[model samples]
Target chain A: MKRFSWDEMMNRYPAFFAIILLVVALTINFILQPNMFARDTLNSNMRVFLPIILLSVGQAIVILGGGIDISVGGIVSIVNTILATQVGLNGSPEKMWTFVFVSIGAGILAGAINGFFIAFLRLQPIITTYATSFLYVGFALFILPNPGGGIPAEIANVYRNTTPLGLPLAFYVIGVVLLVWMYIRSTRYGNYLYAVGGNAEAAYETAVPVTWVLFSTYVASGFMSALAGIAITMLSGSGNAEIGVPMTLTSITAVVIGGTALSGGVGGVAGPVVGAITLGIIQNIISFSRIDTWWETFVKASIIVVALAAPGIINLLRRKKV
Target chain B: MRKFSISPPVAAILLAIVLFLLSGFLPNGYGSDINVAIAQATNIVRLAVFLGVIAAGQTLVIISGFEGIDLSAGSVVTLTAILTYVTVKGEDDKVLLALLISLVVGALIGFVNGLGITFLKISPFVMTLGMSGVVTGLIIIINHGNVSGKVAPIMTRLIARPLSPDIPIPNAIIIWIIFGFLMWLLLERSTFGKHLFAIGVNRVTAKLSGVNVTATNLAVYTLAGALAGFGGFLVVGNTGVVFIALGQPFLFPSIAAVAVGGTLLSGGKGSYWGTMAGAIVLTLITSLLTTMQMPDSVRRMVLGATLLVMISIYGRQRGFRQ
Candidate 1:
């Protein structure tokens, strides 16, 4: 019996299995529909996927630290509402920038409150985040009852029309996010996070600033969520309370499919990025296949289940030596 | 219990009562608006019944030492409802038959979940989540997202129409009480039930003592599925509809009942009675909110805040040693 490193075992787990499936999905799409690989289509899809990509990554951070955030979707909704109303209705472009700052600030503040309860007060992560999700989304609804508020044409143009060196601006945003994620991984806090999830008692034994590390990850997640929310405002040009409701489910699915272990120790940004794209493509697959509009939910749900389950089956096979 | 006397959920019930009374006396307070409160309460009870039913199974699953949070529960509910509707189809004589179908579906779904988590050794979170999505999707595919069929007239009369419609009792409430008692007996008094708690307290310990861990896991998920399936009956009875989205709402509240009732998310150590109490507390709080004329956002905010406060107080620690 060879002693297996956690990393080696993780690679064989269901989380990684799903990531492999995501790759196969994209490959199949390209092989079957060569046009689907066109830069224009890919760019547009990336734009739609950006918020989810950011959100999944942010959420994965918290989950990695042995916590989960149901509130990411709610936070995004809140920020989207604030931005749409402020940028579209009341603020000058300058004030809109201020609005963006304030809204993101609101997200951080809300997340910190979540952190306070989970980290300091010792509430279960699932319950704490679950309750906060409603709080944030309710606040969003309070601010913007309808999806009437709209971003300025210029902001919309940035998302819709802009490219840098022939690459979509959305991809550039991904690039930036990837850079930030890399920086996060480099921080001592990152190491502490991995430790916390892999073995909390051992980390505590080592005297890690466990609580603060936990606190900061949530704050970072909030920042990403708010950024995602603001970007959505520009892309959609309107803010609707219902706009991000689906993201809650989709983000977690994306994170899981990206090969981030639900157990919270292994996996990272690349897998989820691929995972989000595969999911975005799944919608396109349904439409292109001309599956009845009726079957869309069914098909998507099936895909989600299969994606979620495959990893576990793979890990089981590996573990059982069956 | 004289030794166990008061539970967190019991406290929450008392708190809801106090708040309800306070709301009645507040300046412009609307808690005294009885008819409206009852009407609104019917909806919550409708939901609470579905959640409480699922939580009953969750309590069992948790008590089996698996950290078995059934994310797939709502899916099971949806599956059962669709099966019931498609099979029963307003046939008063066949309602019992439809219910039987529901149990089979529950058992099958639970079997799949058990196979994955216990036999295959998949993590509870991932496997159940996959199962959840798959089941929900199955509902959509079966119904095509349409609200079809009629509840057997008697069921509609007995369950859906509520008590005079103007004074609705929500058949869901009736089912909740009857089943609640059934669950209490199964969990507290049965040899099988004792085995479940023993396993949940520690799988190794139970295994060492000759408890069949796999069988217990199977029983837990299967029962959970059955309860959730029954919940589907309550859901359709309450809403008189079956869309892809209907079952999603119950997911959070189902978990909320468990979490807010002092059940450790980690397996073992729980009280289903406490869960029912939590459900009541949730029902009363939401009912109290309805009496007040506030923005939807504000209502959600306050509703959420109440949940957080309840969980913070009741959910802080657990008896599950591990």
Candidate 2:
């Protein structure tokens, strides 16, 4: 029989820690709300988390490609604004579909802008995205100065109530996302992503399409952010200029918790997806536990800090043992 | 380091002149009257002071290298302002004590961040990002979402008042000059400053060359927090009210100012004067946009596009060299 080692398992699967966290959070949530898995409650919860789950997958891809996209939220805001204003409160389904396509296109355009500056122009990923974020949010604000416009009730209800095979509609979306990610991971471009993120110079020397790979990651992130925006708009059943601001930091936190390294070339979409859900569950636990409203942000942030520091602390301990 | 070429600071000066000339086309142009120019200059200086102070610490951390950035600066500023106002409670006599306490609190937070980065090996980006959340949470907890306090009369006058009838400069401008000089001395004159640049250039080599890398990192982050706290005080003085969102806008502009000032986001290779110039340029750009009666959206788009162009000039050179 082969000997088992915790380190080997962690090395082989970077999501180990995140998986454990998710299990713990989910168990606590289940205990708090026994009916959490019930059809209605599950659908509502899944509906809310779906946006972040999609956002995290995109963020994970960017991080894996050895860059960070701080403008995801801005891109999300743009999409939300597009849908809210174009579809209006009483728009028909045809108009909604048309606007949805337009919103996605807008997201791709925003991502392309970021990618051109960072990948082709060779700007710092963080700074370039930070600058572009303002451009996106500012544009969103221009599109909808106030937070009043929203899609029709029927569209939102479709998002909220849809269930297929007794599972929430989000489950199907998640399934599709994972399937797509898996397929991409098996492709040559996927290998190129990891190689470039690990070391762009090394990858370039080995003849990888370094710049194109870099560009595509941001585009992918943009598309994902657009999806997240649509989900959020549907979930809220309204539009706000500032809706996407808070999501940016949360998405990054989710990426970190998912066991992805900020230095890049490690972790995957699964970890971040789990990380996003874990974050959502943690929020549920907090609310279910009846913590003070004031302490909610503090407690959640402290939890994130702890989560961020855990791997580093564990590595130090391992090194000491060695 | 190389043959003479136009650096960012020089470029900033040139840009300032071009902007000034362009502003001549405005109905109330800079050259229209001497008094108008002074008023405009003072306004720009006043706004730049807040951004410059926050960016000052950022410059130090970024100079110290290792992908150093302090995203929590804006949150710290907000927290410190709230703490200062609440503790002082509009009492002139309590200002000094409140300021001291705020500084200490800021330092403690910074120390936690440093500890996480140094001992736990957390990524600076993630650690600081988490710290921002924690600080914001603390603000909410303390204020319970109902912040109420007035800026101390003396503190308000200290920043807003003119130095004297003979001197047209506001006290804020004088204070900024002192802070700017001090930052310049720290970055260009001090041994710690030298070590920072060296470390930013290459951490292992700096460590091998006898730099106390850990100690330096700790000190820089602590100073950054303290400086951010001080910025909080200045902002409160300027606004005369303590609110959660007061310091929010400073977050990106501070970083942008540092980048616009020509500091390398990858760490090291920049100057404080460049940052000061950058801050002024940004404020000028905003003011000019407002003067032209452009909507907020257009202003933001212009700012974002300009930032992209600026970074492209700097980034292309660096990207190609590597």
Strongest candidate by lDDT = 2
Over 4 Å off in model 1, which ranges?
A1-19, A89-92, A315-322, B1-6, B23-50, B65-67, B145-148, B156-177, B238-244, B318-322
Tens-place lDDT digits, model 1, residues A94-137: 87789889988988987898888887777888788889888988
Chain B of candidate 2 achieves a TM-score of 0.95
Candidate with maximal DockQ: 2
* Native-structure RMSD, model 2: 2.0
Looking at candidate 2 chain A, the ten consecutive residues that score lowest on lDDT are A4-13
Question: Interface RMSD in Å per candidate, to 1 decimal?
Answer: 3.0, 1.6
Clashing pairs in 2: none
Give the residue spans of candidate 2 off by over 4 A.
B1-4, B28-31, B90-92, B147-150, B320-322
Q: Model 2's DockQ? A: 0.70
| Ten-residue stretch with the least lDDT total in model 2 chain B | B313-322
Tell me each candidate's TM-score: 0.89, 0.96
Give TM-scores of chain A for all candidates. Answer: 0.91, 0.98
